[model samples]
Target: MTTTRPGGRSARVRSAVLRAAGDMLAEQGFGHLDLAEIGRRAVVGKTTVYRRWGTVAALVADLLDEMAEESLPRTDTGTLLGDLTANARLVADTLTDPRQGPLFAALIASATCDERTAQALHQFYETRVAEWAPCVEQAIARGEVPAGTDPGEVIRAVSAPLYYRLLTTATPPDHTVADRAATAAAVAAERGVYVPAE
Candidate 1:
């Protein structure tokens, strides 16, 4: 296996701590997260964790920032449906992932009670939406959708149903469900459902 330096000791420490925090969040939910436990899990000093993050909300915010920074970029597939399908698939995959799925649910639940965490979660989605909004914009340029269609709204539509299913149902969405989401969003956009009022 290839090896690369994880930037030096400080960066390594940050990586370890964040990874521990994410693991804890995934396994036990945010309500059960403990700084001391995370410190022990990361093999870093408790004082270091306290000094760096100071609070669980801060740590969660940092984790979300890291996720936004590390997430995959949007796909460009020449058609709105194709691009939206790729986006929907990515959302489904993340929401159904053994680790990420629970982590996201925990984050969402935490955000409902914590203002800082809620802000962080909103920012995370905003970043992701901005990354994919161009697909809708491209569709407009290609005359595939209404000229005044709201890209962000269309992009969100593609993921909304998948997320709703994840939150409301026991069954995880498969590729067929993802395709349907993409198709629905594409059809809605094509029909001016996302067009903004004058």
Candidate 2:
């Protein structure tokens, strides 16, 4: 049972391949992705790429998993509004980033047509939402939000409008928009809007 170390050759190959894939996705969209081209760009063997990831969807799923694993942790600001503001700002920053913004757009476009990619995208958001949900839970404990407030719902609310703006128009969500989103979500949560009714 030989095991691959974290910083070994295998890890390097994975990183290079994923980077190439991301660049291609951002530059050319998902329809133009090819394992052979990815291998050439990554300087890894074509056989290695095919054997390791099997299909484009699988490779994309792996990339999404890696992204989820590497995403920044949630901010802890002691106040629900502050924490949510940080979360919204983080989402805005990523959506407005040159490389990340286009990459996410391509990924989302692919997910719309590919079931595997859709599942992967869902998992990615679940991980992100879970990471930030504790802030809402803390708010509940502090009596800032009503009891039984759904932490995941509140976190999702903070990001939904930002994503909507990013996907619907040419305008990127800025810090002011992020701040407003956080404020709205916090206000709604405080009023028990996120709490599930019986």
Candidate 3:
């Protein structure tokens, strides 16, 4: 790696702290990540970490944003079911991955207690859902499903059960479960499960 100095040592300290914090979050879970330890691991002052990132939640929120940005692109397979299934599998794979699954579970648990974490998580899901909403909207326009389908609801249904499986159980939710959830939600939409507003 080329050591391109951006603004001298202060910038380097920030970069080191953020990188160390991210590593701790991904590997040790958010609850186990100590701010002072992060600073120590980064070879920076604790005050510098606190002054820049404030709380653990704030640092983790930024970390989660980085994770979201690095996530895979939404699949557009024409049909709503196919698109949802694709998205479901993506979420399932992420949730079941050895490194990512534990990190996700920890972040989710923290969100229940932290408003900032909750907001960050909500925004992350919103971005992901919006990416795939077009697939469902197109299906509705094509009359493949009911005239009024709430795309957001459909998007949520695909991953909701998968996340539940990820956080609550020992067994990981696989592709088959994802397909089932997507199919059930899509079929429900076909039968006017979510009747759109007039």
TM-score each candidate.
0.95, 0.97, 0.85
Q: Global CA lDDT of candidate 1, please?
A: 0.92
Alpha-carbon lDDT of model 3: 0.81
Q: Write the per-residue lDDT of candidate 2 for residues 45-64, one digit (tens) a residue.
A: 99999998888888888889
Whole-model Cα lDDT of every candidate shown, in order: 0.92, 0.93, 0.81
Off by over 4 Å in 2: 1-7
Collision count for each candidate, in order? 0, 0, 0
Q: TM-score: which candidate is best?
A: 2
**Candidate order by decreasing TM-score:** 2, 1, 3
CA displacement after TM-score superposition, residue 19 of candidate 2 (Å): 0.3
Q: lDDT (0-100) at residue 16 of candidate 3? A: 83
RMSD after Cα superposition, model 2: 2.4
List the pairs of residues colliding in candidate 1: none
Off by over 4 Å in 3: 1-19, 42-47
- lDDT of candidate 3 at residue 80, scale 0 to 100: 81
Sort by lDDT, best first. Answer: 2, 1, 3
